[model samples]
Target chain A: MKYVITLLVGMVTGAVAFVLLLYYNPFVGNQSVSPLAVSELDLVDFSYSLLASDSIVFTNDGESHMQPHPAKVLQLWEPTVKMTRALVTILNDSRGQPAGLGVKFSSDSEKTRLINAEVVVDSVWHIYSPEHGTFFVDQTENFWPYLHDIVVPARLSGGDSWRGSWYGITSTGPGALGIARVTGGAGDFADTEGEAVESIAARAYSAITGPVAMTGKLTIALPRQEALP
Target chain B: MLKIFYLGIVMGIAAAAALVYIYPVVDQHREPSLITVRPNGGNSESFHIRLPGDRIMAGVTGSTELTPLALEWPEHDFLANMQTELFKVRNENDVVIGAASRMSGWSEQHGSFVEWVVHLPARGSMFMTMAAKPSADGYREGKLRAGTREFLTLNGTVIERFVNEADDSDSDNVGRIELVTALVGLPDELE
Candidate 1:
């Protein structure tokens, strides 16, 4: 009778313990909620510049793809479409410090005389170091020069806190000038609307030797955070 | 008193260990199901994905689920449904080849701008920029603008289709995306 009672007690104690363990399981709770709050900056106004050599122009004019066009602005006879992708430096009041990375892809068509530009910016400058090159903020790897591999992963891994996308529109001409607006964004620039004016410097377009000097001012209006009750 | 305390501790420890061992086995059965990629043949492949919940959509950068963002201007008469999404790309064999970004938007000034950037690691990346509008059947067709490396000189057209209304309650199926790529330019060896 004592053995039976002891066995019952053990079984009951074990079942209660198991239920408690299940109730407080560490892995079962909600992990999707981000710990970081959105930035409080109401308006972010910044300027950015892209050097000519930093941009690559891929044309469908049947020209040799290997031919070097470092300036990125190409002159073609046929009604061709050119896809240009550039890595630009985001600046603050023309100052280099606290600068960040910008990746812009523009598709220009001579046939339609239209240009569509998609720009992705990481304003905090998470993974890019001008002197030591590109390295992870966590210091996992050595200085890697490839911005293509670094930018996407940095954006994906949530290391890029100040990130957004601004879609721009421009027309094709001898000396082209265009404007852009905030189409969509994430992070600090979420629910934001702003305007930016982009223009190619006269010298960059006229001379093939000079780099494509692009200057633009971006004014983004961040949404106000709701007050907690 | 000491014996009872020791016995309770021992039972608690044993029960915790047993629960840890059994939890995974039970939890595996409760996880959401996933479907395989179904091929439509002739250069077209279709993918089935779950419709992510609102929590996943609101948190853009870090959410584990694939989130599509509305990228349209509110005031403009631009098509109401401008969106952009980035997700993993799989080949016909359903092996994850790389990642691709898709942006679909339309404006009265620009007409329709649908672009896909497919980045294949080590091999190269392809940019397919289509000016064409979606058909009545809801599929958009566009020409390949440019490529790098292996796809450098290839000319192709991609047909994209988003099929079926997602039945969120259905475990077997949720949604589907179909992509058909027809290439025109290839080297003699590849041809």
Candidate 2:
């Protein structure tokens, strides 16, 4: 009976601790990470290519998997819905130091038509690498869904940031041109307007989600920033 | 009896820990409510869940609170300033099924834009981009732009409402997210 009493007391204490930790913990709050300011620049242009090998694809009835860099084709059969989230590597042909672009889009069952698409271009944050890989602190880590506080591979810095909606066809073998319009942005991209013209390549002769490749040019005109005193 | 007190305490603590761990497991396995409503002869499925819990934003993990923002000048840290709020997607029955992320900002190009993504476990994910801003009553509504897997064939709208009631016990901002999806040509037997 004495042991039972002690056990009951300990249990109550544990419950209280759990409640406090769940409710009153001080670590519960929101914080934002800021980017650096940029110099005077009006027009910024850069190009990017899709890293098909490093692309991660998900489907409802089809297979969901990730193909590392150099992966050419992502295959799915009879898929009703498919989504591909891939990192587009910034090419070296930008007039100014090019930050980079991130692209994600979902496709219809045929995998040849694009449904919903979006792109983000930022000067600081990136998940691309030069040696055919992503920017995970651990090179082995390839997925982004479960990752947070990722390493900022400040590949290019000019305080340029933009997010926009993209539309186009996901056809294989020199696919149709897709375009993205700048909808919102910050820094050098603030008050700016532009569009991205993209073309995709795949080994499949027809509409198939296999062996994908892409390249695009991003051109945005930045508004003049008032010189700070 | 005195000697058993220490053992009792240890056993009690273990029991409490076990209970806490079991709660979520049971919650996760509970049958998800898949409510289907046909409006105008189209298959419409609605999911309503209160998202009054923790959030991981820009690497900061903590309980979420509805802190009003001052949308004035541009924030130098654009990524952080986007306030990419990420939360777990729970069903109306409070079953943890998936996760979601939402961010809203203003720019000269577009007055105000909101981007939100919802990922359903093994079911695929969907994205919604809305031009509408939140109202004084604390709700933002928009149409579903794109989706994958089960969300692909459906065209619908998502409304997120925030409930700010003063609870003396908990000092965090509690809110609810409602996803009302109207699927076109969705086979009734499709899961």
Candidate of highest DockQ: 2
iRMS values in order, in angstroms? 21.2, 18.0
Could you tell me every candidate's TM-score relative to the true structure? 0.33, 0.38
Could you give me the TM-score of model 2 versus the true structure?
0.38
Residue A117 deviation, candidate 2, in Å?
27
Native contacts recovered, in order, as a fraction for each? 0.04, 0.20
Which CAPRI category fits model 2? incorrect
Looking at candidate 1, what is the lDDT of residue B16?
A: 60
lDDT of 2 by residue, B2-25 (tens): 556655556655666676554332
Candidate 1 error regions (>4 Å): A1-229, B1-82, B107-109, B165-173, B186-191
Clashing pairs for predicted structure model 1, backbone only: A52-A212
Q: Give lDDT tens digits, candidate 2, residues A103-183.
A: 332222122110111111111112221111111110011111101111111112233211222222221111112223332
